[model samples]
Target: MTHISTTNPATEETIATYDVMTSDVAFDKIEKCHEAFLEWRTKSHADRAPYLRKIAAALRDNADAFATLMTEETGKLLRDGQTEVKLCAQIFEYTAEHGPEILADEDRKHSGGEKRGMITYAPIGVIYSIQPWNFPVYQPVRVLASNLMAGNGVILKHASICTGSGLMLRDVCMKAGLPEGLFDVVIVDHDTSDAMIENKLVRGVTMTGSDGGGRHIGQVATKNLKKSVLELGSNDAYLVLEDADIELAVKTCVQGRLYNNSETCVSAKRFVVTEAVYDAFTSAFVEQMKAIRLGDPTAEDTQLGPLSSAEQFDTISEQVSKSVEGGAEVLCGGSAPDRTGYYYPATVLANCQPGTPAYDDEIFGPVAAIIKAKDDADAMRIANDSRYGLGGGIFSKDEDKALQLARDHFDTGMVRINSFGAADPNMPFGGVKDSGFGREHGGFGMKEFVNTKAIYLP
Candidate 1:
């Protein structure tokens, strides 16, 4: 038997352990997937729709179990966990309803009547997905929906911490009448990840992780000539102008950071508050950060929870200390909660030097650092100075100014004015520069898994 163990960050206990396949077993699984995909890819889009629908049904039926397991393993709020599960179903359903059309036959004419051309979408072979643990089920669900509908088999190298969640996903897909080998979950360490990439079984790979990890994996994928998409790290900045609505800005910004116990790569890290409104914004932001409840993740009333692991806590804490050393202010919370769990208080550091450790770096835990900007130019400079260009925000009463800030900036991918970092399935989601390479969860997602073949007939 091959499986991995689960750790409860809340209790410092090993809740369960499952087997992880050996190299031989993994290679065999690859063989099975390759065999299955040949027939699976030939199936009509109409045929694929039913399996997608069944997956949605299975997820809805087992939502409770999935949510509980998610909370137990990652220490996120129960509702947040449920949201992830629900989104999983929604993604599958959306694909079922709209995917076939996206892959429909393309009509074209070329060289007058002498020759005619058409564009047809066909499935790529195997897609290797290296996923993160933050969204657990939701993250994989997005990948699964797009790849499966595109008639591609997927080999998921999910995060070790979310091993249990990954198994549940595989089980649900199988129960939905999907072929056994269409999707296989592999629980291998980093070394095996490199091996899988080099195995010649993985045709394309998409990864979401730290910037450094993405670069390494991407290099390997490129070397192997495998198409790759990566959603790496982000240090989003929320620029609040003096004319902005203080109340709405503060509320939305907090949600962006604390949405996943601050584990999200897209969470806002730098609060570039203009000097004129810095005082008021800080006061209200601290008030909101204080009211957040850090109860057990299984509790529905809990708004905030612990980081997924001790290492996450340590990293965030170290960043805060570095910020203070470089002359920063602790607006509200800085240290971890005084108890047993991996709970860190909602830390706020002010007077953080732009481009310093705290302001520019991606903190994958529940801590925020604010920097006061002298003017709009300073705010733009601070926002652009980051090595990362994933997502960002600008809050201003003047619509023109807000739009201008977004346009005249180096912030790549997506930018939400007066809102937080959220990805609607209909919207294209990806980062630029050091953040990541390709898009996910939209029409663009399907392209990653399919071969866009153009045909000529005479």
Candidate 2:
């Protein structure tokens, strides 16, 4: 009789409640997914492409409805919700078009001249995905689209706050001609989720969440001897170098920090500015942050929305308070408003130093920490002084120098020069260090849960 209730963060109203499945019911879903995988793996890549295309069409056809539902469930901007659905559609289209070529067997010449070798990519069994609520549709679709194209079945245990989005996606896939049991959404508690990870049929575990959650899942998967991919939390730094464009840097950095209510893992949480332009960038950034319009997510004029939940709001508020107590300065916003819903303003913290939450922790809300560096070298050094290395950015007028810095100096898995973006379908995404491992976009994701078999011909 366990249940999870969904709420509208903007209105503070309950939307609906869903019953959590018992252990037996959850296992039955897993069994059905495994059975589908057996048949799906036997199909050729060509046969799977059309179904993926159908999924893309279904997403696009129902984008408006799905986007509204996501906004209602997660407090994301309505326009952003629509954009998320479109991005997911693009992922499906990309996987369908390129999956066959990427998964094709590679012809290789053996070290011995007399022998020839070929490497073939083969689909593994069910992949268990545990996703977060920030980018509800895109997050799950990022894993599901690539896995389905690789001929593997997927079972999702999405964040309880967005359970309706997960189930709706499953319904959309089925309506698009996807075979039943191929993709399943399970509603279960934490204990059942851990047991599902240990299930023999789940060959791989992929999760996108906090660093703490990643550690727990990674340990459980390791104990069970299953391959796991974790995309954990990050406090990514966006460096404003001495030779940067001040105007462009200020605008882009603000957008980077406040996008998606600033809940994005790859969003620019820390601003590392060189001494040469630190004053100018900081002034402009604070002014812009203070002017942001925070209101109803459904309103087109509203640039920011409430946090996904009250817990998220409390976490951000506590981090800001601790950072201020540890010697950080509030440039614009530092406290939550006395409002009915879980709303926090776009905040900018200045004079940020090490050992403070503002500088060290990932503030998963609309808060930006600004730090001053002596020069470009110092800025780069400051950016790398973090345990989390998921994503970072560089802003410089010299494209050549920025590209060189990104390639040679940046220590993260993904970096941008003079720009900020969450993800791209054609690029490899993921991170190193405490941010977790495994790449998810481009052609890399299609093979993460696949097996590589080598055959030699002499």
Candidate 3:
């Protein structure tokens, strides 16, 4: 009898309500997904690739409708929604084209070349995915694209706020010739979700959310002896070196911060600038943040949109307030406006030091925390001081030096030099430390839930 209500954060209106599935119903769906996996696993990778291509074409064909639905449900900009659809389509295409090559069986010589051996990547059963509202389509597609190509069925328990998008994606896949039950979305309460995770049919669990959620899911998967991949939240830092292009750094950082209305996990939340360029970068960054147009998400000129929900707005507001109380200076925006919906203006916090939320926590909104470093070394040190290391960036005129630093010094899972990006289908994505474990994309995801069976021919 329980249900989830989808709301438009930009308009503060309920879009639709979906009934939550009972434990029995959820289990039935899981059973069906497992059955689909059994049948899907029997197909060759070549056979699977065409369906993925069809899915990609369907995504493009329906991009407008899907993007509008996402924007309506999550308050993301219309353009952003469209971009997400395109990105997801690209992910499906990439997985279809490259998955088989990545999952091909490997031949090796055993015991000093005396015997022949082979290692095959075999599909497991159902993979349970728990995704977030931000980048609703991309988050789920990122997991689904790889798993589908790997011949594994997927079951999604998406964020309550974006349940509609989740179900829509499932429908889209099915409409694109994906077999029934190959991808399923379950609307359920927390208890039901936990029960699903505990279900023996689910061989692996992949989640993209906060660290707290990741910990709970990871523990459950561990206790049940199921594999898991967690992509948790982070307060990623973007370092501006003394020799950096201040203008370019400011521009890129602004785009990164406000990309998803500044609700992205990998968005540059913290700005660590060397003393030499700190003033310039901070001034320009604050000015840009101050001038951002925050209004209707459908407006083409609007640069920032509302937070995904009132709860999300409250969280960001409290984080900013606590940071200010902890000795951080508000450069532009520090409080919510009196406007309707869950709108929070683009905010910039400076004079940030350790022991402050601005310095330590992830501000999941249109807020930027600026930190001053004595030099490049100090900037690097400051960037590595965070407990979360999901992703980070460094900007320097010397591309070689920046590349080396990112390769050898940056402690995060993914890093960008002289630019910023959320993800690339061909590159490995994930993080270390409290940011959670396991990589996605870049052929890594296609094998995460696959069994590597070893065979010896003596």
TM-score of every candidate: 0.96, 0.99, 0.99
The Cα RMSD in angstroms, rounded to one decimal, for candidate 1 relative to the true structure is 1.8
Off by over 4 Å in 1: 1-4, 112-114, 407-410
Global CA lDDT of candidate 2, please? 0.93
Worst 10 residues of 1 by lDDT: 1-10
For residues 1-458, write the lDDT of model 1, one tens digit per residue.
35567788888789788777677777777778888999999898878999999999999999989988888889878887787788888889988888898888788988866678999889988888899999889888888898899899998888888888998899988987999999989887777778888888778999999999999999999999989999997888888888889998999889987888888877888888998889999999999998888868877688888889877778878888888888888888887668988888887888887546787788887778788889878888888887788888889888888997788764778888888856777878898889988888776798886789999987
Cα RMSD, each candidate: 1.8, 0.9, 0.9
Error of 3 at 406 (Å): 1.0
Q: Estimate candidate 1's alpha-carbon lDDT, on a 0 to 1 scale.
A: 0.85
Cα shift from native, residue 425, model 2 (Å): 0.7
lDDT of 2 by residue, 174-224 (tens): 999998999999999989999999888889999999999999999999999
Which residue pairs in model 1 clash with each other? 2-19, 2-20, 3-18, 3-19, 3-20, 4-18, 333-347
1 or 2: which has the higher TM-score? 2
Model 3 Cα lDDT, one tens digit per residue, 124-169: 9899999999998999999999999999999999999998899889
Off by over 4 Å in 2: none
Model 2 superposed RMSD (Cα): 0.9
